[model samples]
Target: MRTLRDDNILKLPDGRQLGYGEYGDPNGKPFILFHGNPNSRLLWGVIPGSPFLPGTRLIAPDRPGFGLTDFKEGVTTLENWHNDVIALADSLGIKKFAVFGPSGGGPFALACAWKIPERLTSVGVFASVGPFLPETVVNASPTVRTLWKYAPRLPGLFRVQMRFFAWLARYFPNLYVRMILTEFSETDRKDYARLKVADFLRPDRSEGFRQRGICTWYDAMIPATWPIPLKEIKIKVFLWQGKEDISVPFAMGRYIAEQIPDFEATFINGFGHFWIFEHKHMGEMLEVLVPPSSSPRSK
Candidate 1:
């Protein structure tokens, strides 16, 4: 695992520095990974083992205000993120690549699909979030649903809440892990224990909140409107949704599937948001974009 960290910051044309992490084969196919809310690029390093395809290079970037990236207020929007992504890829001399968006990062993936489909080969979303509508909010888990519904209206309060959560994750990791497990399904809880994800989450989240919680508030509120035109996306999208997922409800995934012009969906029966990534689901998701010869086999 190799992270670009602060030393390898990619200086964008706009004078903003973007922090990123790189994993898997350095000289292989490129894939940009968009992490979920309250998370930084460090989330990719936390996966128990290297689940990325053998011939694949995974690059995860910290959105503005997260990790080592400098925050730009009033400049952060779904559409605006595409420009940053394009700049990142251009700087790497990568003309085209695949994109994978997980949880809160899903909308950004869609944003790329919509804004820069010509620069992408494929798009995949894992337990991805959807437009925050009344129906979607009502179906989501308690903690996330509340944040989604009220974050935009009460940005300051939600920022404080996210700050508290980040503090808990940093200082009291065990309690933070337990609190997160409460919303997952029974199967997910068992997998979380088996993987002992608690160990990695502390550092992953610590980096995510390196700039504190303001980015989280914006991440939570941005999905409410989905300013991008999903219907205009021409790239084929592959997605996996766990029926038991409450953190991002099944309905949200369904809504996304319905809106995409070309989408392939695998709706799992018993899985939830977190466990799916820890197991076979990730390998299966990767196979959708990469060639079979370079695909990874799940442990």
Candidate 2:
């Protein structure tokens, strides 16, 4: 995928430098995109002509330990994650904005909603991870279930595993890409084939691991303690789920929808975990989260 322009750096109060890339309109309504695990800000480049481009300033930040962002000490919990986001927004002079979280990014988006609902216009989660309870795990894909069950307890093992994958992604790019494509459902496979998505994914996958393989592994291994105060979120909340998603499981979305009051949940049949970035699905989500408005466009 082609790299986007306006890759900027923000120096936080603690002197940590945060790296981010700007997509779409620079002066448009701020819309933050939280990338999935093992991804960086560059992941946004994969979405072709994103609908948010019309009137939204899509901000993709390289989360701690990813891309050019430096990792901070004692910044592991969800609260710390949200605070980092808030700090970034403050540095950018943004008071309010919408947030979109896909896959592993889901929990971080929810953290923003939970911690700073007063500063948000809306929250959107697509193919997200819900409360990681026993019931959710029982119904999840074998790979997902096993990771959630054992990763935390075996962090060293998980790190070693990620390092191996990173080595494969760096050296045997084509084979590594094929290994990932093989995990998608039939519907996802069809979409991916038609879209030629692998080209866009290659850079992010390779660079993301190269920069923060250990940190990503550590973050993924941490267990999620549920009952996240979803009921307290005052901003508009939208949930998009793929009924056929094996990575997160449909049950996770259902559970989250039940917890959030007045939340809009859309379940797409035959879609998989990657549906959020698929052309049709992504268009639908952008329409709901960033409808074309007559309001003056950002400068």
What are the clashing pairs of model 2?
A: 27-298
Candidate 2 error regions (>4 Å)? 1-6, 49-51, 181-183, 222-227, 294-299
Q: Model 2, 92: alpha-carbon shift in Å?
A: 1.9
lDDT of 1 by residue, 1-299 (tens): 45434235898888888988887766777888898867788887777565666667788898777888887887777879999999888887888888999888888898999989998878999878878887766667677777677788988788898888778877887887889777766767876777776676667788888876777878888767568777788999998888878888888898888889999988888777765556555666877887656533211
CA RMSD of all predictions: 3.5, 2.6
Model 1, stretches more than 4 Å misplaced?
Answer: 1-7, 292-299
lDDT of 2 by residue, 209-287 (tens): 7553765675565445443577876666899888887667788888888888778999988777767666666657867
**How much does candidate 1 score in TM-score?**
0.91
